[model samples]
Target: MILKYIVERNNKYKTIREVLKNEFKISSRLLTKLRSNKKVLLNGFSTYFDKEINFNDIVEVYLNYEEDNSNIVPNNIPLDIIYEDESFIVINKPAGIAIHPSCLHYDNSLSNGVKYYFDKIGLKKKIRPVNRLDKDTSGLVIFAKNEYIQECLVRQMNSALFYKEYMAIVNGILEQKSGVIDVSIARKENSIIERCVSNDGENAVTLYEVLKSFDNLSLLKCILKTGRTHQIRVHCKFIGHPIIGDTLYGTKSDIISRQALHAYKVKFIHPLYNNTVEFCAPLPDDFRKIIENEI
Candidate 1:
């Protein structure tokens, strides 16, 4: 393992070991190992543990470990692959399926599902998801089959080169036909809850238009301008209309088990072919049924 850190102005006066443990959150044992192995260096020169650091000082620590093959596993899991080529794949993920395994969820995730599919096709490298959807939200998901394609698609996402369209069902009818929700959001607790219009938060934006209106339910087409966790749900709640069935930020309803949101369309430049590619997933049966009966 190679660890790199650049000293910032806030902690310029601390010693290298102090900075590593306090600022960078490195364990003291790890620092001692790096120092003992003489793998701790400043500006390419091996530095002592007590060396005083300054602003802009670059420190590197090299650790010994075998390469990671933990992510490479073969399991025969079902996946709805919409499109696939040499460099990339697009799949329609279903609700109740997580995108990746984390501490809370260790198996039965979309990442594992992708790995299983690749193994079925005899591909070795792990597929990397470009964007993520919440576990309960279903929609089109894109994955890069190789590192080169992964970097390209990641750059596109950071530059907002890709277009994403989502469909949502809110609790009430909007007074306006079309509008934008510009709010800042931040996490409130350790839970998945978030606060909108927060003073100390990052900017989040969502553009929406009403597609149809029922007595108390509204079908909405939403385009995300900035991708923030729980942006759509939080913003909808901020505007006095929360996503129907969103247990986290809205009044619970019987329309759906989870938040009524779906990533319907995605458009981007293909990584391997270098041409524009677009994919879409039709609304899930449950969503359509809710609309048909409510609206």
Candidate 2:
């Protein structure tokens, strides 16, 4: 992706380096790569970085370059892509698919599938997923197409610019229909994959509202203020309302094959255009069935 910058009256008489660093907020690391790759253009031609420019000076930084992604074995696993742009791709991932390739997942991971899609489209950029969801959690996942874009989006995490919303089905009806859970969470002792609520941990906050109740279960609309490993799961468990099928934090159940959680919405500022955008993932089959059949 080529980021264009027009030097306006207030942004005039600054070097390309200053313009990119101060005005465009380009990281030093990304600037170095752009310089090395001769990707920075001034007035439709390559120019010295330190050269001073005035009003209307057009500066463009090209980031849609190719890279070697052979480390991940591309697989043709099906993907539920929601939106795609020159800067990023958003996917509505189903339950049971790992995000990144691992020793056990190998080529069956979502990254592998994304690699295949990128290759098919002739895009050789590295796979850079901006956010993560657990293997058993269905969610909206954003994958940045370039490193610059990745950095821009990643910086928005846990901030007002990025908003993550989820729908969760948990055991027992909540007494408080709407409330916030402010607690700290840390890695469980001697456990690599488990998280627990503790005083000696990172401050995690979750704002939740009870949306629906059926029998012994309640549907909750959860908004994560601080993103941590298994944050919602750990917080729900701390409040004595763990997700219905979250075996790691709660208990296994036949009502749902995986964790009864879904990242239904994601809102963020588009890095390239600075436009606030939001996307929603439709509830998957199992989640919809439970709500429809149970009610």
Candidate 3:
């Protein structure tokens, strides 16, 4: 991949170093690698970092010129890919699949599946997930093809520019049509996986709007203001409308085997393309069954 930059007017940048640092936002590690690889070009020619340039000059940086070797073992597990490009891929991850390799789940994971797909397509790049969803939560998940794209997307995720929306089925009908849950959450004592609302925990915020109501359940649209571990689960419990089948925060249900939560949408600015991009994943079959009165 080649990144092209054209100097424009009203600029304070005078040197390549300034342009790279301020305009391009290149990391020191990647800059060092670029220097070693001799891939940085100015006006279609190799140039030093200190070389001077004028307005409208073109600067190009080549990336992924060599094949990358990753340790993640490839497997033939199937993937539901929604979108794919040279820089990234969006997958509709199903329930019961881990994002990456863990002690209990090593081969039959999304990472391994991505490795297999990339290998089959003859693309050599490491698997890098921009965000994660719980094992039981199904939704859209983004993965970058290279280190530069991964770092750029991660920076956006840490900022206010990235957005994630979820759809969930809660246990009870909410009194208020919509509301915000502003609370602090901390891991429960002596438990590695449980989280609860506490004054001594990190700040968490969630916005929710009731979409539809059923006999004993309510479908809700949830938007996360801050990403926390099991945030939606804990916040829904805090609001007295825990998600259905959430064994950790709420009681189990027969309608769904796992928590009835889905990451429905994601929106972000393209780090390299300079355009806004959004993706949506349709509700899984189990969620549709409950909403359509099939369960």
Per-model TM-score on C-alpha atoms: 0.74, 0.96, 0.94
Q: Which rank order by TM-score, best down to worst?
A: 2, 3, 1
Reference-based lDDT, each prediction: 0.79, 0.90, 0.89
Report the lDDT tens digits of candidate 1 across residue range 67-149: 23366454566878888877688889888988888776667888888877876676666558988898889999988775445
Query: Candidate 3 — which residues are off by over 4 angstroms?
Result: 8-11
Collision pairs in model 1 = none
Candidate 2 global Cα RMSD? 1.5
- Give the clash total for candidate 3: 0
Residue 179: error of model 2 in Å?
Answer: 0.3
Runs in model 1 lying further than 4 Å from the true structure: 1-69, 189-195
Report clash pairs, candidate 3.
none
Model 3 residue 215 CA deviation in Å: 1.9
Best by lDDT: 2
- When summed lDDT is taken over every stretch of 10 residues in candidate 1, the lowest stretch is 63-72
* lDDT, residue 197, candidate 2: 91
Badly placed stretches (over 4 Å) of model 2 are none
TM-score of 3: 0.94
